[model samples]
Target: MSVPQAKSPPKAFDADSAQRALRLARETLQIEANALIALDQRLADGDHSIVQAVQLLLNCHGRVVVSGIGKSGHIARKIAATLASTGTPALFVHPAEAAHGDLGMITAHDVFIAISNSGEASELMSIGPIIKRMGAKLIAMTGNADSSLGELADVHLNTRVDKEACPLNLAPTASTTAALAMGDALAVAVLDARGFREEDFARSHPGGALGRRLLTHVRDVMRSGADIPAVSADTSLSAALEEITKKGMAMTAIVDVDGRVLGVFTDGDLRRLIEHVQDFTKLSIADVMHANPRTIEPQRLAVDAVAMMEEFRINQLLVADADGILVGALHIHDLTRAKVI
Candidate 1:
């Protein structure tokens, strides 16, 4: 058997060389920055076509159909997802599919967003007339305004870049980045124009942690009823500790005969009381408990409870209503377990 050739040794890292590499990266970033700034200037040139298109799109009764191919397709899909997630109803459709039967997805009241770096994607050309004939507005995003798609569009947003970040100066590097950024800007602009709120966004992402944090009310995760570790104000500290231990909570609530909450006695309070009085059996829970403990309403958000805990530097809290009645109890771990922390 022929002997295998020795593998090349790994290159050693030099701090000076690393600094030079970072400097080069910083320099390349300026090129993309300048491209975006130039795009801003072009938009500011007041051609008004893209702005008018956006205004019309915002008024659209149907979905926004975003179509593109290759690298542009990826950016268009992201833009579509962003718009739909925010407030606008939008979806991505491949131009190649439009040439088949997917063109039927477009409606007269919808808006079409087409992406083509060279503005001459042949696949998009066949679907352009179909969208127009359907009375749908066409918004073109391209690097060249003079290309066929740009010329035919009702509005053309220029994404012209000075040069590609690639060493060959031919790859879709800077141009694609610029197009994606412009797409985000448009999506956010429309989102803001439509008055999209956090609650609206949460609706789009209900299964996500953000939605859980926003949509979950205090009652959803609070321990309520008999699960609440509560004791009458006349109860002894030893009895409160028993309730706390039985409930597996570090604290117990001091309540009135009407079940209304009066105060709370925490492990911290027990520690302090232990330092002064060795006899917990003789101490009443009312004497050792902290009167007027911070409480939350059942309708309050678990996120708000976390903020309160952080602000108060406390780990446990009682849930009560306007009548000061003990309805539930919440611990910091509760929020953590709910992934609201």
Candidate 2:
């Protein structure tokens, strides 16, 4: 690996120009914010376009095909991803590419959303008629409701902004922000209407933290079988200590003939026992064990076990079956290693 050298900013872009830069940034944000605010207010004025668009999307039996050209293409791809993650099946296709061969990806059951701020993208305009003729619902998101693309659409979403955030007003700044916000609004509305939930989202993102919390069960991360440190209730304290050390759990479960949990003796209990008793060579495991210890079921989520541990301030927990039989054990390290803590 090579270390890179640090360099100073150019004289033209030094601290002297920071105030101008900050002013431009704040003005850009305010302009974009105002555009979103205007959009929200417009939607509240008995707008049938948005409602009709949502209805078509919710009723779509096939995927939602989102297409755009140039800068709008970037926004369209992100919208498609957001929709897909939030329970609506969607995909992005380049307008130019769709005219070549990707149009086959669309079907009669689909709802095709075309995004173009100016509503005048030549590529999208070229195929707008064909998409509608093929029976797919055409939705146009544009700054101009009267533009060719919007006029051809079954539903036209007005993503108009008073002006661009760019100083020259040529760049698609506020318009693109408005389009992005509108897409987010659609996704959220669809997500709510479909009754999408955290668990559903977690299923789609199984490798994420929420998935690990919801999908991982106690049985999936506990120490089971011979790996458990356990002993008979009448076993000597010395033998219980040996079992705890051999299993390397710093604790031992005191069980009966059927392995039903009678009590638990851990290192914490041993330290307390030493203060109360002088010689414990003759003491049975049951005499010094903590009875009726906090236990979790094997079927519970690992995250639930973590909550139980935190609530009780216990570092170790026992897993019991319906019959009160000790099935397994867990140490805080187990949860940590499983990334559930």
Q: Cα RMSD to native, each candidate?
A: 3.6, 4.6
**TM match of model 2 to true structure:** 0.94
Pairs clashing within candidate 2: none
lDDT string, candidate 2, 187-297, tens digits: 998898899999899888889998899889999999999999999988999989999999999999999899899899999999988898999898999988889888999
- Write one digit per residue (lDDT tens) for candidate 1, span 1-341: 99999999967779988997888688678878888888888778875665676797788999999989998999999989998898889999999988899988889999999999899899998889888988998999998899999998988888989898766888788898899888888888888888888889888898998899899888989998788999999898778899999998799999888988889988888777768786667778888788988999999988999989999999998999888888899988889898888
Worst 10 residues of 1 by lDDT: 45-54
lDDT of 2: 0.93
What C-alpha lDDT, on a 0 to 100 scale, does residue 337 get in candidate 1?
A: 91
List the candidates' TM-scores in order: 0.91, 0.94
Q: Judged by lDDT, which candidate is best? A: 2
lDDT of each: 0.88, 0.93
